[model samples]
Target: MNLLAQTTNRVPWQRLTTAYGRGTDIPRLMETGQYEEIANLIEHQSTLWQATPWALLILLRELAKQKPDKVSSKEVQLYLAVASAITVDHMDSQDTVGTMNELLDEKYLWPEDEDEDELLWEEEEPPGYAKEAFFSYYYFSYLLLKDAIPIYTAIMNGNDKLAPAIRELLLLLEPEGVSE
Candidate 1:
């Protein structure tokens, strides 16, 4: 199944807008690589709609299609940076946390093994579900990059709440030499 298609199909195309104008008009903007419009309109202060990530994802896809040579991983890094900044601000609200929790569960990607019979201190086998969930936040999202931002912030700023998982996200984006 095409995940991007699945997500975009659910969008209320008429309701979403960007810096250049409505998201429906993205195709027009993409002809010229409306990069600025995407950067400006995709974000709403520190909040991002589910459409936001989808928009950037679309932009990346379009860029690849139009001129694959012009596309760069920087686009991915920059988009995440912007979304990550806003996600930090949104993290202050319980609503974001609640939404995050619900999504994690719904996605069947929750990291923890909730069965009480499982010992809390037990050392489980390698590569458990938590390992998978750690990676999921980097790839999946219907709520924009909200789930990614705070976890990234936590990893970057050492928030500790989602430290291990967020650290996993950071590793995906981190430069090889930056470890020093």
Candidate 2:
């Protein structure tokens, strides 16, 4: 099925529209099934995917404190594994892809509501290797979130330290660096 039909069929079109902005029929646009465009929109919309290195490190630190359990522990470990892979992949390709600064400038973030012409100037030109690295990073990061939400919901419902720990970890991963 088309992405738009899938998204609308799964989520309320109104809520998706409100969150993503109006006039642009995201669901309709996604009907093309072009993975790259879908990826761009996902990266642009989600702060979690764009988290800084330090923020991700802090999240790992907090997650380290949590006790091992059947579900949440496994999920957290899975996320960390994926994150580590992305990091390793980035590092290995550093020579060809240039530094993280270059990758961040080119492939990391997406533009906000702006005209194509304006976006052209604002967007960085990523090398082929850099684009590949980013695509790997984005795909795994997205999968991690998909795994986290259910665990988060369960933690929230339970009266355990797990919820608070996860909340702290998420706070650490917030867009703005942690406050002093």
Candidate 3:
């Protein structure tokens, strides 16, 4: 079974925040493989959102399911975009990771959305949970992306152009004191 199918219903996408607003549109966008739209909503301005991890996970899983020769260039481009988004230096800082881990221990206070038709918060200022949501989203996405190094290797093995970049991205994800 597809990981997307497994979590699509379980994750309260409507309640989760994205770069745009709510992640309510993620599933629909994903169904059509709209990589550009998905990337924009999940990681606008290089900031990862609450929906980023799920979107990345599903994309990786979908890539893993396909034969290397059968994978489309668009899909590979999306993979490259995701790798760049997660491995950016600032996002991997010790301070940021520590804060994300600390927040992970506390129960998340999801923002309430009384009206599904209306926006969750004003564009000028997001709700308080916004920061917490970013931390949580980034943390989980980092972990998920780190674990996906093997998948990255497998996908890029024979591809001369992308393999080196994937290796560099994977190096960034490696834990301290460990080298591979």
Candidate 4:
């Protein structure tokens, strides 16, 4: 399906875009570099809780569509795990240990039967630089994924007011040494 058609067919996308366009001043906030303000608006006006799941699903669905043969089952599992970790449950639940364990297990492109903690800690200690690099990569990935939906919707709707700020943020989050 075409990109627009694929986007419109998803209920979550429709709801998120509708709520954002009508209730949130994304354009103004983006234009002004008021990320905190925009975040507050999203928290109050948009169905953000619902949108997170929908966004992850949409990303995986799009990936599947683009490369159905290459998108392995392990990748899908990892996507779901990462999405779960970033969702509301992360804050509300006491089972973070179990949840994070699940996340580590699924995140590997190749599924490993061993426990994640074993690989992360029990094995030889990873160099400090490696750990720092891993943390940086994960942090930037989270930021991009979290911000992608709003930015994309804003641009698609001709909301140029926020475009420059969004582009700036995207640039900042882009991996080191990578050119926009």
Pick the lDDT winner: 3
Q: Estimate each model's TM-score.
A: 0.38, 0.28, 0.66, 0.24
**Root mean square deviation (Cα) for candidate 1:** 16.3
Better of 2 and 3 by lDDT: 3
**lDDT tens per residue, model 2, 1-180:** 111111111222222111233213444533443323333333343322223221222233333344434335434433433333333223233334333223344333334333443344344752222355444344334333433444455554563645665555344333342332
lDDT of each: 0.40, 0.35, 0.60, 0.34
Tell how far residue 155 is off in model 4, in angstroms. Answer: 2.8
lDDT of 3 at 180: 23
The residue pairs found clashing in candidate 4 are: none
lDDT of 4 at 78: 31
lDDT tens readout by residue for model 4, 27-108? 4543454435444433333123223333333443344343233333333333323332343322222422222112222232
The Cα error of candidate 4 at residue 117, in Å, is 22
Quick one: ranking by TM-score, best first?
3, 1, 2, 4
Preferred candidate (lDDT higher): 1 or 3:
3
Which is the winner by TM-score between candidate 2 and candidate 3? 3
lDDT of 1: 0.40
Ranking by lDDT: 3, 1, 2, 4
Q: List the residue pairs that clash in candidate 1.
A: 18-41, 19-41
Model 3 residue 165 distance off true place after TM-score fit, in angstroms? 4.9
Task: State each model's C-alpha RMSD to the native.
Answer: 16.3, 14.9, 6.0, 16.8
